[model samples]
Target: MSFGPFLLLALLEGTVMAAVLALTAVGLSLVFGVMRVVNVAHGEFFMLGAVGAWFITYYLPLPPGLAWLVALIIAPLVVGAIAALADVTILKRLKYDPEATIVATIGLLYILQQAALTFYGPDARPVEPPFSLRLQFPWFGYSGYKLFVVAAAGAILLAVWLFMTRTKAGLVMRATQVDMETARAFGINVDRVYAGTFALGAALAAAAAVLIVPIQQAHYLMGHDPLLLSFIVVIIGGLGSIRGTLIAALLIGLSDGVISMFFSPTLAKIIATLLVAMVLVFRPQGLFGARA
Candidate 1:
């Protein structure tokens, strides 16, 4: 293959990475934007989704497509419910104190991780793709499922944007994000909003995990890299900015894919870290975040 085709392949791979990362980072950004709480366990929720997918498909006596469809719907809901429960039980009790919530979520992360390790076991497992067709490019063939991942993520993101921009629920969430006390004054249920937002964020992460698990194996420890990369994306794109998150995910994901293809994964990560540091030094508010 020529360099052009090779690069095109890299770009396609990067788009897949970007699609999943955008969903995960947007979830993180949304939680912080509305609740003003950093969810350290967000990644674990993602891991749980992957494990859930594995369990659902592994045990279900359905056709591969049907099983995948079922897992896709159930996994996110389960993880979201767990997240909502944690918010009510732990974060709410602490009054969502910034420092306290951080510590609490860190604890939650360990708890979920260990729980997964205990039950899900340590082996990495792969789920069969919902479809097996491959699209042939001039120089090579690519997984149709991977292309579907990109499309699915895009469709989900579009739905999210529409929900946030056009729905009453989105308005309430935005209002809460702007001023929790004022929104409460206006008759919004602040507690309920917080719980819902947390759940929504976890659901997004889980959804991303489900989309990517077919390509990447599900493992208890798989959350670590996504978590780290999400933080980087959120920081570079500007915390709480969905548009920024998308842009940053593309930049980081494409760079990582191309660099890893030509060089090393470690170098790609190092470059991303450095980019985050530079962004922090120059634009503390993030690329799209408003100055506070």
Candidate 2:
């Protein structure tokens, strides 16, 4: 392929990757933003979603599209519930102490991972796309479903932004983030808020997983990259800045796609690491995070 065609393909792949990353990372950002908890298990939630999607599509008698649609709706809910349960049983009991929660979530991560391995097995499984339409480019044909994935992610992100900015529930979450004591003084249930926040974060990861599982595959250990990339995005975009997360995700995604296409995937990752180091040294607050 010529440079133009290759570059176009790279850009397309990068956009898809970015959409998934933003979806997953935003959840992490939300959890830290509101509850001040670092969830090491966030990636496990993503893996769970992929696993859940596989289960749903595999067992259901419906057509591929219908089964995929069902998986999209159900997997995230299941992951969210699991997260809420963990919050109530583990993190809450630890009093949401930052250090303790980190350790607690590390355990949570192992527990979820092992459970997936035990039951879901070690093999990677693919979920067929709901629709298989291909869009014809001048030089190539591209997945219509991939474009839909991008649109779906964009819609979900927009909805999340609206929820945070427009809804009363969002107001409560924001208030809690701003000041837990003040929010509680005004009658917010801090404990419930934390639990819900954690669940929401996990659900977002699951949703992202479900969307991408068709392009990729469901595997027990698939959470590692999403976790690492999401953390990098959170750090670079700012701790709680949604806008920053989106922008950083785009930057990383495009760079990864183009670089990986032009050079090598390992080199792309190394560049990303170097970018993070630069961001840390030059702008410790992150490009979008508020100054501490």
Candidate 3:
């Protein structure tokens, strides 16, 4: 076994996997931090975004890159709209009932899943990289498109961080997350904040799905792995902290990549899950979480 190839593969997977983890977990963090609602249908939104992007790119005679771009931009907006509608119509009504919020999202998850199945069937559909850019990276060669995804995900994450830290909207979001009543008292429209935050979280999930579709393909149930992974990340990172989520995501991504490189992927996943379980038992606030 050539250690060099395995090392390279591990590095590649770690990098991209971290991006995926960040994308998926950030949304979960946002929802938890601000709205205090767990969206069971988050994965379904990811699937919806991927499928929606695929259709636009494939059926519209657009260039492959353009198609993916369309998916990247449009899918998130569409999913965000759906989320906003749900927030206004359902979640808002049950603001005081956390259990009801969970149940409602679970119901939405099933509806979205069934709708995806009915439209795309049960088979997994592969989506090709928009263009062939044979980029040589000194030792590790990769398709130009995968490189694009890596770059795009990184840029998006940076943008999100900036938005959260620098923008007025970000301040408002933080205020809402910390205390809705206080934010409302301060003249911020709490309802608007909740709706916008929910939409933003949904959009983030959708955007991640768009980025991942080329590698994972468009499947009705494609969101399952991401959703599960996101939950694990949030738990490991501390429920509502973006810094914690980012750190834990990197930890999990690197751990999974190295484990898979050394052992079978299946076994690696099992080990990862065990590690998470142990972490939860020992450090319920997460590795990066502040001790409450």
Every model: Cα RMSD to truth: 1.0, 1.1, 1.7
lDDT of each: 0.94, 0.93, 0.84
- What is the C-alpha lDDT profile of model 1 across 162-265, one tens digit per residue? 99999999999999999999999999999999999999999999999999999998999999998999999999889888898999999888988999998999
The TM-scores of all predictions, comma-separated, are 0.98, 0.97, 0.94
Q: Model 2, stretches more than 4 Å misplaced?
A: none
Which of the two candidates, 2 or 3, achieves a greater lDDT against the reference? Answer: 2
Please identify which of the two predictions, 1 or 3, would achieve the higher lDDT against the true structure: 1
After superposing candidate 3 on the true structure, give the runs of residues whose Cα lies further than 4 Å from its correct spot. 137-140
lDDT of 3 by residue, 256-279 (tens): 788877788788777767877988
